[model samples]
Target: MNNVKNLNKWANAHTYLSLDLVRIALGVFLFMKGISFITNIQYLQDLISPIDKIGGGMFLIHYIAPAHMVGGIMIAFGLLTRWAIIAQLPILIGAIIVNFMGEMHSQNLLLAILILGICVFFLFYGSGKHSADYYFKMQQ
Candidate 1:
């Protein structure tokens, strides 16, 4: 019980360090990928060409790119971080769905899993610095 108290004290003290760093890293990583999804239409088409070859409309592709980019920006900015992480789930899931399973190994899957883990972490524990939760704490 005493050990648990000490651990909790340490956690609360270091909250800003671990939480903010993770949030910033996650945000930037998502931002770059988001930009790629939005700006590089040809790339998106190439990877998912099977869908279109079978008659997936231009409309779906058009919307997906922008949505990915916008979602990335929101995550990076720590605006609705949980929602943004939740939003990214589809794009990664879609990649797994549309891509040949054999083409992906554990490495690729791990990256997706890692991103989801990061999102889940932030969802449960808000970015602790200069974030809405932090501000509220400061008020208290």
Candidate 2:
């Protein structure tokens, strides 16, 4: 009986209720910031200074923003945990390299670091059973 209980616990270990709050918050924040890029264009343009125009920024706003927002919402809902984490990974990496490591002001670097750290957390822990990954894997 004990063995069976342990197995159940292990299988259920990844549930959303068991997931980390930090990861959730990260997704929410990233989603909002991404949306802000399009919604508040002037603010974002001001932030991404030194580039005559961030071609990359346009890429992110158009291609990556929607993905990040969708992934983030899924992550927040514990829907598609692994996919969300994986999708957000490139955004974080580029963020760290572009804004923080670049010639931008200190605030930009700090924001990049904050976002990067949360993305890294999700990359590692996942949404657990609370995520769609749990059910999908079982079907497999």
Instruction: Identify the candidate with maximal lDDT.
Output: 1
Instruction: Look at candidate 2 and tell me the lDDT of residue 51.
Output: 44
Model 1 lDDT tens row, 1-140? 57634544454566766567677777777777767766777876776665666675486577666666676666656666657667777766666555554355566567777876777776555455545544555689
Clashes of each: 0, 7
Give the C-alpha lDDT of model 1: 0.64
RMSD of each: 6.0, 5.9
User: How big is the positional error of residue 130 in model 1, measured in Å on the Cα after superposition?
Assistant: 3.5
Poorest 10 consecutive residues of model 1 by lDDT? 3-12
Clashing pairs in 2: 14-128, 14-129, 15-128, 15-129, 15-130, 16-129, 16-130
Query: Which parts of model 2 have CA positions greater than 4 angstroms off?
Result: 1-18, 46-57, 100-102, 135-140
Clashing pairs in 1: none
lDDT of 1 at 5: 45
What are the TM-scores, per candidate, against the unseen true structure? 0.66, 0.66
lDDT of 2 at 3: 65
